[model samples]
Target: MNNQASRSPVFKAMLETEMEESLSDTIKLSDVSHGALCAFVDFLYTAEAPLDDDMACDLLVLANKYEINHLKNYGENFLISKLNWESSLKNYSFAHQHNAKTLLDDALSLILDTMDNLNEREEYLELVEKDPRLVVNIYEAYYSKTGRCCRCHQS
Candidate 1:
């Protein structure tokens, strides 16, 4: 892709720096899904993508990787709209992984709102086993909202 066609700062910078020498002119995005890369390129060209829940998650990762703030925000909003009890923990983890603070906080809030039954879910158990730190963070957030420290229970 030409530098002008790349709206992403990361991609644009890479193209500018790497294309200067031009022994080979290819950007390898091995980690990004085919669908996400395609949608990202389409968005860079036309400012649009056929976003859905699955695509939004994939696109968010691509957006974050490329430092494309507009597409990142779009992906965050789409994920927020899809959030619910069933998707909270997964979204929370995904948001954290992608450095999407807004989505992470929103998902955490929903998890706290339903904290009474959160542990009953299979996902919760799986999360606790896979990443105990995240479960601890959830409790920390819950206690903070109630005006107490999780460690000492002080106001």
Candidate 2:
């Protein structure tokens, strides 16, 4: 990594802003805000992101904590760019909870296809009930094409 990457004006500005926001709260709670967070943010901004587990973990948590959607999304995409089953749920849930809708949709599709037989009918119905909009959209798609939900697609 270029050592001077940390000296960029843009990266400095963002780090300063984020530290100001996060440190005050962290300090009040006396959580001992490590300078590593700033260093990690600097790395994210300047250098190509480090692909190591330690760097990835730090970025994932920091992105979500700072509400940095782009960084969070970038980290999510990075985790996915090299896929592994063990990390899937962790990354997907983090992305979904932080409002990464497109990623969430992809993750859910994978879950649905791979784990279809794992859930009982009642569980599937409950999921649909919780997100009734999904059902409505499916029904609407069918209705628009042929009128009414097909038995195969209906909740």
Candidate 3:
């Protein structure tokens, strides 16, 4: 994850070192927790992750905010399955800011499916980083299915 942190856009993370001062006995960990990051990597590799609701929600927000589509999809799907609702607007804001369209779509889809839109959702169409290839693909597939040839209407 340290290696990944170096590779990804620096603006993507809220990385901070907060320490808990120990007054009495405390067992120290030999290594930092790899749980979320490892799960994220697994999601990247296989499009599958074994995450509980809370963990999946947390990581999905991070992944979406970080513009990590693969991880976001996997985490969102996991959360959808578990029906996690603690996922917040912070996730949506980051996703919108970073221009991760597919992830935002998946997240909104999950929200619709779970019937949990506790936070306000405004028109996110202002998130304007549309992928041309995705648009073309959707047009081709959808227009062809409807026998309309969407490209012809673009003139």
Candidate 4:
């Protein structure tokens, strides 16, 4: 049996003996990139993983999937610390998809704070085209925070 005492409870649950032999002996993570999978395994063993924006995003997904709250928080914090207006939209979308509450709120705040110029950006247009609901959420957040519609201020 794997030494799972150091792992998160969710991870340890996957080691129950009644699971399939393949699952009991080896966990397959075909959805995660090889690099992210390696980093995840490294974190499992050492409780440390190298983080960058790309790696952080990748690991955040894996952390959430495996219910490793420490890694999830680490990834969210790393992304938040690195966030800028240029990347906030994409990060906001990523955070929303991954359920990273802190990162999501921070990125949404940045987006709303800079909403005056947001629609003029190519990324903003791309977001509108690809995920109109997220754009609507951004507008809703803007109104909730400022007590006025996003359209009220548009030139």
Score residue 148 of candidate 3 by CA lDDT.
Answer: 69
The C-alpha stretches of model 2 lying farther than 4 A from their native spots are 1-39, 44-47, 84-86, 117-155
Q: Tens digit of lDDT per residue, candidate 4, span 1-155? A: 26742365654666665666336566667898889988988887887899988999999998888788989998999999999999999999899899999999999999988989998999899998989999999988888887775677542
The C-alpha stretches of model 1 lying farther than 4 A from their native spots are 3-6, 18-23, 149-155
Instruction: Give lDDT per model, in order.
Output: 0.86, 0.50, 0.48, 0.85
Runs in model 3 lying further than 4 Å from the true structure: 1-33, 84-155
**Each prediction's TM-score against the native?**
0.88, 0.46, 0.34, 0.87
User: Which candidate number maximizes lDDT?
Assistant: 1
How big is the positional error of residue 154 in model 3, measured in Å on the Cα after superposition? 43
Clashes of each: 0, 0, 0, 0
Which parts of model 4 are misplaced by more than 4 Å? 21-24, 149-155
- Arrange candidates, best lDDT first: 1, 4, 2, 3
lDDT by residue for model 1 over 1-155, one digit each (tens)?
A: 77533677776676667464233566777898888889988887777899999999999988888898988998999999999999999999889889999999999999999999997999999999988999999998899888887779788
Evaluated against the true structure, the overall lDDT of model 3 is 0.48
Residue-level lDDT of model 3, residues 19-81, one tens digit each, is 331222222323324687576666555667777865676666666556666666766555445
TM-score for candidate 4, please give it.
0.87
lDDT of 4: 0.85
Worst 10 residues of 2 by lDDT: 24-33
